[model samples]
Target: MLNAMSFAHTVGNIRHHFPGLPTLLAKATPERSGDILAGIAAKSAEERVAAQCALADLPLQHFLNDQVVPYETDEVTRLIIDTHNAKAFAPVQSLTVGELRNWLLSDEATPERLAALAPGLTPEMAAAVSKLMRLQDLIVAAAKIRVVTRFRTTVGLPGRLSARLQPNHPTDDPAGIAASILDGLLLGSGDAVIGINPAGDSPAVTAHLLRLIDALRQRFSIPIQSCVLAHITTQMAALESGAPVDLIFQSIAGTEAANRSFGINLALLKEANDAGQKLNRGTVGDNVMYFETGQGSALSANAHYGAGGLGVDQQTLEARAYAVARAFSPMLVNTVVGFIGPEYLYNGKQITRAGLEDHFCGKLLGLPMGCDVCYTNHAEADQDDTDALLTLLGAAGVNYIMGVPGADDVMLNYQSTSFHDALYVRRILGLKPAPEFEAWLAGDEYARLMLEATHPERLLTA
Candidate 1:
């Protein structure tokens, strides 16, 4: 049996005590408005650092013992425990959380080694180590790990970047969506997947949008996959109606309760994954599920509670969501980082930090991680902030990013990176799109303008 545990640290004259593991995790988290709003943030900077100091000394094995959300009530916790690779974990099993952080930044954590370590590290463990890292640390460590996946094309390969061509429209108008699709394609984007967030959820509407995108792909012989980002059930229904479903899309959260709030569970996700796989649609690879998560989703849903009713911080909950994603061997998993708005992220710095954290944690946990790198009008962030984050993610070797027209989603009413933005990153970072898609960009129809390096406006006119 485990003994009762208490965590405390002294900063200057004050001794701060964290009553429980959840509280320690929460207090140790970097300052974010979401934790502050949830009433779980440290009362002062000193206390926060004290929590961090205390957290650094805690043995890594304790996370395996302490259930932040008890295993019985939360299947996410159960999944973490039941699937953990004990042998893989043995290397770092003896170390404290702080030692894990140092090792991650050390020369030993190569891509292959980190990939092997992925099955060993739990989300709480990843989140714990992340709190002790700076932004550059997050970037350098995340870049060292590679979690590649495949659907119609390869993603997460080193020295390559991909973009999700999000041709979203306010009315789901075919013409407008096609125009945006053309824009992304001409600009050498959409190698990740041409995903559309439908305005309506009706099965018929979803099916129609699926047909539209599939038709475009077939007609052009584009070496890419297409998805209509509807709910899982809606996508399943559309699939049953014989829609050309290439990938199943859903918004997932950390806790079982938060997932329930989203009208999803593990069984349901498995059903959807099975449904997508049975289609036999993917040519290059069979990874067919797509998942999107954000930091504040659990708190926003009022399902962020842990053992003893202490609130789990949003970043930890976000990391937990990655466990859910990894379970399915998904083709794509991205955090819609700033899309949750200022109430959670508050400003540019927080958004940037959260993006790096999400990317780092997701990569650490063996997911093909990406970020939306977006914000709303009400948020205190601007285009410059988005550009900075976009470039940073590029440098971090992020697998994919969203490619919206003009950096704006008319339907979702948010600002994201544009097709031109993808070009800029590729030029600056010496990255290219997926190999299959790059070959297609050199085809007859697009090669004249795209490959020859003629003016972009000429392709626009074409």
Candidate 2:
């Protein structure tokens, strides 16, 4: 099903980008090598190399070997290689706009395939897809060239806080809901991070996190590594009050929120930088994480209001959000999570899959792109459509995703499909699926059996 040479070329490209992985592989034992190879086999070659390098403890150059030659090209491999090489070197040399256009209009333009496959596609839909593809191309190009004149890498805290849970009325039993979500995350073999939105200087939320930490320790033997707080002042207070705050950060929802929060954001950053100066003195060490949110779908009332009536047009909103993000780069360079949902509700209207993909590629060049809450319709629904959507998103370079299960009845089933899609993406990215991943999702006895078959060493390495 896969062309080996093309696969090799992609892997080679990944190796080129991250040069510390091969040494890690070389240092692994036979069993570890097998495990690593299995992991790599589960993902795309490029992703496999990326993950390896990302997690590797070695220096960058150790994984790179300029003398390591790739297998010569076949037709498919040649095309992929040319495209890859062109993309890699385009900025330094010459890559014509015409060439880029032709590439999109080619058979590989994802929308063309979707049109042939999805009965829902119309001519207008096709045009939208093309526009998104071009826009993504432009954004990626711009990100590659954008210069950073200022480096205000430190972040600060706000004096207050605010919080909202989606579906407005979250389950009355917040503890039960939290447990279910965390259980799914720990049990599932996917990367998971919890985001806490503690509003109004409430100590209750801090207590809730304390309970979570205890539960994780007692039940799962997992350590609470960090917390991503939406408000800075509350974050610092939480940290001071024995909360395991590994990284200090802030969250921005939309344009108006950006404007309203800009002063606060800057003030907090300046304060944090100032504090770091006093604490660390002459030495420079980063004790905080700074993340800026780009434009996202108005999934909540607050988000809608905060975004200042930015219409639900994906392209326009994305452009505006990107402009703000670029302007705030100096303040947000520590870590920036780009756009969230073009949620399913507005799927055909404001944001299309293609548009989301383009926006992601554009904003997440050097930063992490957090894939916002993944909500699907149901398992009984057309999962192939969902799979196609996931495929498109993955191809556009989404490394972090928030997967919530059982948000609704349909979402429960959809969560299963989401896991499947995640596994598929993992394979495409060259990451190995955990053993018994399917069985665990199926809720089989094998699930518990596989849990008992844990390799603590592997878990430690991971």
Candidate 3:
């Protein structure tokens, strides 16, 4: 909860950024302010959020001077905004869902800008804004930012399904990592990003894995890049060791403290970005950041409350994390949606819901969205649950999926989609792997397997 004056000052930066807000907010009268606050109590969660956006649009000093109400909880302030600015929202309210969808399809709106504006809209209103556009709109907006990432390899998404090789090992052994990389490539699943999380946590170990992945990529001469998920400092060490690193990877949280706990700061990220840009090894421009995020990281880190104007549901906080990823211009953002387990997500139903929500939010905000399609040992989930999530996201225009050995993560002790799963979805939906890699696979021993995987009837005869 914020005092009227403090809340105003807090999101003042946001207000500053939203053009024409001051003029728009200047028209609210005292009587309407009372009605707006009164009306807010009865609305749904989406409606309440919409109302809050209206209040946030006003000048704090003037709004405080009016002291429309005692300004109790932030929710109160939010509802008051809705009550006060009913007229502004009236136009939104009156627009049919189809009309809003068509408007979004037109050149008049963008996912990035709409994301910035969505916090003030009800989910219904936001849906009205994006119902038809959904994955298609998200893909376009994300590609605009996704294209400039470091080692910018386009995943050939919506056209071709993409998969990553997560050959994580307990010791970060080069042999073990290389074997996993080869396995994924053989399975036609390394098109997303061939990366590892060095559980050993040693910069040297991370560097070794980085070297191993790059070496294999070159040895096979496949069109791919590598990610080593270590602290920026550790990755920098790998870079200093002359490892051919393609992407800078980090696990980001929704708030500043949680992000700091992960040993990341904007300054540190900028330094890594600078280093990655210097590598400049991709045919695409310098979009190089790779981020993995889950819903509970902020709550786990105890940084959920500091989200400022960003609402505090798991979905909102998760989206806020994507906003941070956007700042660094990441090429890929994986919402480890179900990987956090039932402690945060409860059951498969909750997990599935959160996965879809996170995907929609991330893609809507224009991050090259991929889903981990994962679950942990402790989660009340199974292979069937994961398959459902994988299929759902695939249909939703996902950019990539993880390709771990047999869909099992040895180092992290989680269950995620495997190379076969990628094949399953692609074969079912007629999705291809990225063009360059698919072409490479076509020329080799993989040609038969690729063909069989494409048309399973061939497998029965073979």
Candidate 4:
């Protein structure tokens, strides 16, 4: 059975972090949150959850309907777009690194502004952006951002690594989902997160999956948590049903209205954070939020980084995505760098450049960065392209990578790192999982089995 009392204690601790949540929860009696108390051992888990919900007077529905900010055109960018002067050059789209450097340094140079146009830049163009920048530029940019790399309020040990166990399926089959999770864990991959984005939008489906994950922990004997990447309201339904949900997952954009359009705002996020804190499923630290972001989420919602609809360069907006993570202690923050295909990157070169650039930027700004070193069928890339980038990112100190079955996201239809790929990186770079998880994986049959398969020399021989 779940520890309701322990959960209550964690919930009480949440107010210490988010000072704004107390008033919304002020009505509870006995100096304890009634919703958290409902989860105490005196009541069966279900009844306690119901009592808690009733006591809190919580509205467990997707209710935010904010507007997306419009993109604004900047004057310098406007003149270039209007005059179309670059089109006269020799296929300006295919410029070399030297050519790109000359172009940026030529007239009214703005490396940051020009860098913003990178999503539309070709691979060659992105390479120039990555290599040619002066250290001062990155130093200047890093100084402006606020970030957090550890669990809330700094409690993580460094020189460790983790991976997101992305167990997803098209039909949302419980057995299939369980099998994939087994695959990832056996390969030593669930350190950062063990979560799923349910293919179906039904609350029942999410509840069913959450229960399956809860039951599996004992059978597998591993310390891990699950995320049903459903609507926050849907997750609330599962939470009401008394399922084991560790973190609330969402894809946040840059603008407020856009986040609301996706049914989340600061207030809603706070409520979810408070509830997760109360649940206390985190094994690494106290953070209970997981977020996935890519460039263009803001514009996709009709919000622009600027006032005149000229979109903000992706780096600025992407950094803004990292900035918001500091609001809550985020356990995992993935910048799906190349998942959007070449439409933004234009080729493998640009895709590779963006992966490294985003990783460096997020890390410098204090985020535990994970790269979805992935590519779609439409992208001008293959496994080899991603493999090279993965090695580089591993060398660059990324906190984690995505662990899917065979590196194939059957549900999302994107190709990423597989369980074996995680093992490969670990073996080559001498990296290990989070300390506690490594202890849990210690001497288990599955770990032995994986060892025999991955490194037969580690096995006892006659």
Q: Per-candidate TM vs. native?
A: 0.96, 0.44, 0.70, 0.64
Q: Which ten residues in a row have the lowest lDDT in candidate 3?
A: 26-35
Rank ordering of all candidates by lDDT, starting from the highest: 1, 3, 4, 2
The clash number for model 3 is 8
lDDT tens digits, residue span 218-331, model 2 = 344331223434366666666556554444455533234333434344446556445433333111233334354433332232222211121222222233233223322322
Please provide, for model 4 over 68-180, each residue's C-alpha lDDT reduced to its tens digit, 9 standing for 90 to 100.
12212222222212332233333334544345444544543343444333223322122123333443333333222223233311212344557789889889877678777
Give model 3 RMSD, 1 decimal. 11.0
Which model is ahead, 1 or 4, in terms of lDDT?
1
lDDT of 3 by residue, 81-121 (tens): 34343333443344544455554455655534444433333
Write the candidate numbers in order of decreasing TM-score.
1, 3, 4, 2
State each model's CA lDDT, in order. 0.91, 0.32, 0.61, 0.57
Q: How close is candidate 3 to the true structure, as a TM-score?
A: 0.70
Candidate 2 matches the true fold with a TM-score of 0.44
User: At residue 59, what lDDT does model 2 achieve?
Assistant: 24
Better of 2 and 3 by TM-score: 3
Among the numbered candidates, top lDDT falls to 1
Compare candidates 1 and 2 on TM-score and give the better one: 1
Error of 3 at 299 (Å): 0.6
